[model samples]
Target: MTTPTAPLILFDDDHYMYVFEDQASAEAGWEMPDEFTVGFDAPARPLSMTGEPLDVRLALAGEVPEEAELRRLVADHCRGHLRGQVPPQATALADFVAALPREGR
Candidate 1:
């Protein structure tokens, strides 16, 4: 098991944030990139064996995301992952977001 690189790459889609080692791994194993859970901060960041900039790309992907970014990602994930009936996690996220004071409203 080789050590993962510091400056990783992230591929963010509608639902999940995929972690990659490099541009090549990101491109080759795009179909099955390592899934990153939004909002929840892990002890260590996810490492991908295989590996750029598409939807919402992050340069320092190894570092934790900011609060606003987390909220945005969570919202997007909930929106895309939700279907038929709303999942418990999605409902929780919605309630959490709703409780937060907005700028105007």
Candidate 2:
């Protein structure tokens, strides 16, 4: 008897379910970063494109930092890569920081 193999799970939001298909299709659809560990979320989280309240997932590669530390790290990364100015997004780091419900800021 042959042993059954567990399904592979790849996590790009758009391609999340592509694992059910063949390897080529899965490879073509897999585009999420290889790094990152899920950490941090927003207060009074916003709705998704489907208009459903969605939990915001933020991640950082190895060595996930504490909230305050993460904030500083993100500031540095953005300043360096964004040329000291980040492009506008519906939700942003500053917005997330300010939106925190506690005195951590």
Candidate 3:
């Protein structure tokens, strides 16, 4: 049986990451650097599109960072990658991050 999967954002040596279809895909495609044994992987936490709050484990740099931190990281990624409004996937991710409710609100 195939394991159920969801969207994921994977980080490499660089500060940026891409939204992968799932964890398996990310693992399969990832080209790891020999210096670092493991890379960071976080659930995309795509709550805005579904309109349902999800309980997902947030992982980054071997530590669990807060959702706000994840949002900031994603925002930075989008800002750096966005051209004259081209990459629709990045645009979509930016929208998702924008839609997330502020923590403790």
Candidate 4:
């Protein structure tokens, strides 16, 4: 039997983001950096999309100096990659974040 895969999305607090069929596809499409690793973990707080506690692991170099910017970039890339198959929940997530202002900006 084939193992089930969970849907994934690249999200940002502001700017860009997108939904993917699964984590592997998302990672491949994004060409995730070697230093970065993606995994499913319970978020510190519940997220609107999954509605359960879940977050993607993004390990990168030295404390991600500009986290906000990096997130925006990731989201932007995802938006392009996820041209089709934008799930309702993911759309809601995008819309919600789009409505928000950039952090401390």
Candidate 5:
């Protein structure tokens, strides 16, 4: 219902100036941070977010618990969510979809 002022906050899905709150609480939650749009964009520019904001931190806590496939997909989704248009993976996908947990697949 509201955004947290805590330093470790993430995003949700409300479409307010604040990004979606922590998504990890729901089924579709990717266990990633919901970023603030203003941080990505230049304060002076309109509708433009080109780089990681000074205030935003990209690092997640601890090692990613998911398998490589899930981690990669989640990372890709996060990048696209925050930066838009994530690039091709450095390695071959290599049965990435096949590797997902049954529930994930």
Candidate 6:
């Protein structure tokens, strides 16, 4: 089978997050088995100059119906995914964005 593309990385002053190609492959979707668990020995290092720990999270979108809808979908999915994983109180917001296009970077 062909390998999947690397996921996108988006960082805020406070955290580092990742976005999958589609919602089904993301944590918000049902595709992952219930037994799944992240295995990182240490928390992700922050890309910010401050050198803080990154609070990584995921986002999903099956297929946005419109351009405006894509933003809402990403926001909603990210919010839910970050809830208990990050802090008791958290909201979705973009800070620094980076992604690899289909063409070679």
CA RMSD per model (angstroms): 12.0, 15.7, 12.3, 13.1, 16.1, 15.0
List residue ranges in candidate 6 displaced over 4 A: 1-65, 84-105
Candidate 2 clashes: the total is: 0
* Ranking according to TM-score, highest score first: 3, 1, 2, 4, 6, 5
Better of 5 and 6 by lDDT: 5
Model 1: residues >4 Å from true position, as ranges?
Answer: 1-12, 17-65, 84-105
Give the Å shift of residue 94 in candidate 3. Answer: 12
TM-score of each: 0.29, 0.28, 0.46, 0.27, 0.19, 0.22
Query: Could you tell me the TM-score of candidate 6?
Result: 0.22
lDDT tens digits, residues 4-102, model 3? Answer: 224555444455555555554544454443212223233333211111123222223333324455566655555775544322233354465334322
Model 5 misplacement above 4 A: 1-66, 84-105
For candidate 5, the per-residue lDDT at 12 reads 32
What stretches of model 4 exceed 4 Å from their correct place? Answer: 1-5, 12-14, 32-105
Task: Look at candidate 4 and tell me the lDDT of residue 100.
Answer: 31
Q: Pick the winner on TM-score between candidates 1 and 3.
A: 3
lDDT string, candidate 2, 6-90, tens digits: 1212223322111212223323433333422222222212111111123222222233224454354444445654466642333
**lDDT tens digits, residue span 11-32, model 4:** 5434345444544454455443
Model 3's alpha-carbon lDDT is 0.41
State the RMSD for candidate 1.
12.0
1-100: candidate 1 lDDT, tens digit per residue: 3333322324244455443434344444444333422322221233333233222322233554354554555455456754453322433433543343
| Each model's total of backbone clashes | 3, 0, 0, 0, 7, 0
Better of 1 and 6 by lDDT: 1
In model 4, how large is the Cα lDDT of residue 79? Answer: 68
